[model samples]
Target: MTDWAAFTGFTGLVLVVLLSFAYVSRGVPHGDGASVSFDDNPDRETSLDGSRNDVELDGDELVSAATTENVVDGVSSTPIVPTPDSAAVSSDLPTHLLIANVAVSQALLGAFLALGAWYAEIPSAALGISAGDVPTKLGVGLALGLGLYAANRVGSSLSRQFGFTPDEALRESLTPESRAGWVLLLFVALPLIAGFEELLFRGALVGAVAVGFDVSPWLMAAVSSAAFGAGHSAQGRLGIVVTGLLGFVLAAAFVLTQSLLVVVVAHYLVNALEFVGNELFGW
Candidate 1:
């Protein structure tokens, strides 16, 4: 029998991922300039020839003895200074690409969240999880801890040829507030993130391939996980490889547990650790 459900899910996923990539490359709207504003009003209009009747200044008069016209020997003339308004305008010019990137990033994330709610049926209210459940939260934390350790170890080794150190690198990535933040994020934000990822990558993509290609669920899992890693290549070559490996782990978890819930929880835990460690400890 045709697995119509899986095929539909996979098609939806391809659309979502492509849109996300386009959005990230484009960035999002950061809003109008918040920098200083200029007031171009002058005290009085000065003559272009350098004469100002209000200031009693001679237009053509040479004020310095070293004026080029007054110089007896060969010398370069002093350069003319441009008006402040001209300089200000030049400096204040905005880059169109930068603005476009900002706009794209914001628009893309909004689109993804909306799609998740509309198509994936992830409840908006349930997006953020609670931290009150200590045992479950810690389990999530441990999964993240393991994933992070493994990823860091592998990533560090690969990047070591370029003089990067994993221990110091991980420490530098985390911050105190971010530590607290990720703890909350692990409990709250991670689930939401994991839910969407699983829906897109595992539930949608892997399921689709398994049905359409008449392949084993395991093979489908591997392919989908690989795609997930490739999506993160923007982080860097090594980061991409690490992310891909992480995706494999996630797929394996799903295969063993057969529960999207478990994999999502695990993914969230690992990401929380990574984000927190980077922000708090500077690793």
Candidate 2:
């Protein structure tokens, strides 16, 4: 039998973390305008009006594509102006520092969760860390991530139609200047975010909660997905709703696969693709 005391502790902890994140993120500027985008070139970033930022990059730093009008399919179009959060890294937090800070925060949070689970006598397998076929799981994860991203694109378009603009400020604010920053984002921060979020939101919130209460995982998913949305409230209302839907999908996947790795990989790809799509494809 599961320990209700330990379960309650986990529930409380999750609630506090989600609420805190939602609170802090509300301070970040939300973009009502369209999202910032760059081209396939590593050197290009975004800002429009064909002007360089006042703050100069050192040495071989990546140049931006935002400040100029670029021709796509024979039509000259300028990128959307970034919100205050990314208008200048100088006034706000620098991009690299922000990425590093997030990486550190995720690491610390993951450690805490791990320790708590151990103390609660929760096995790793119960948390969706079973010995499974790695290759097949990864392939499945990749496909799911790609598929979800496509759905996300459609959802975003529909949200815009409904006059609910999806905020892209957080993503814009994380735009990197140096190659090192990209490395940190792709290798460290993204993986940590994926692992920690899936572990907490799906593995614990949906899977473990159902097992402990002998309740339907779908009911747990509904409850947990709300918290997932709350945690992303910095992204604004449309984002919160969209993210909540995405969370439910992932939660369902976790219920079906019983593997955190699947969701982790899928989650990582969704984020990574968003960054890449904007930076490289201007999508």
Candidate 3:
């Protein structure tokens, strides 16, 4: 068993999982609906206490119920404009089912990679398992993750501005709408995705391959980063480019620090914050 063997096995596993995911996602509906926003929320109302659900006075008594539309002083303030006719939101896809599928696939692939690496007897350091400046790595990773997330938002906006409105169909389709589903996303799905992707792309693809082949880590970073971007084809063409650039940055970080932990933390925060921001602020 050698580092090359581990890398080869890992790439094979990744190809299998990615191909399977692409095949399985063929039926996912494209998002014809525009991004949901606060202005679209019909239930919001302005009152003496500020904003909240609609409050109305009837016979000297205030009545309150879940609002169907915004109303004030015998007038309908917000019309319930319907969602787009072609919107995927009309479909009955379950977010939990999507999350479960992703979690299981990543978990299986990660487990296999781990087993292969262990059998290959790859040095722990080569695999980025050493306890190197734990606090600094964590801190920098967190900051990097936050910065990347902000940059991601800006990049997406710029893409849209340039007549390349990103097809967020895949993201919208997988978005969880319930508390329980959100819990699963933040705690289970996100961490696994970040960890497994960082392990495969940065650790094995860049680190191990570079070390074993006596190749420049930067070269491996480009190769691995390209694959990383292709792995996210579900996000559409623009998404592929954006994700690839982001992947290159992560790969470079791995090459520089030689610590997968930093990239993992950064990746996790980027994804976690993306979901949280979308769910809360509809960003």
Among the numbered candidates, top TM-score falls to 2
Query: lDDT per model, in order?
Result: 0.43, 0.66, 0.65
Q: How many residue pairs clash in each candidate?
A: 33, 9, 0
For model 2, give the 10-residue run with minimal summed lDDT: 71-80
Model 2, residue 149: distance off in Å is 0.7
lDDT of 1 by residue, 52-129 (tens): 333333445424311421222111010000011221122322333222232344345435645544564433222232
Q: What are the per-residue Cα lDDT tens digits for candidate 3 across 232-278?
A: 65454445556777889999888888899999999998887776777
TM-score of 3: 0.74
Query: What is the descending lDDT order?
Result: 2, 3, 1
Candidate 2 structure, TM-score to reference:
0.76
> lDDT by residue for model 2 over 62-87, one digit each (tens)?
23222222211111011111112222
lDDT score, candidate 2, position 105: 67
Off by over 4 Å in 1: 1-10, 13-141, 144-158, 161-189, 208-213
- Ten contiguous residues minimizing lDDT sum, candidate 3: 75-84
Which scores greater on lDDT, model 1 or model 3?
A: 3
Runs with alpha carbons beyond 4 Å of true place in candidate 3: 1-3, 23-93
Mark the regions of model 2 whose C-alpha exceeds 4 Å error after superposition: 1-4, 32-91, 157-165
Q: If scored against the real structure, what TM-score would every candidate get? A: 0.49, 0.76, 0.74
State, as a TM-score between 0 and 1, how close model 1 is to the true structure.
Answer: 0.49
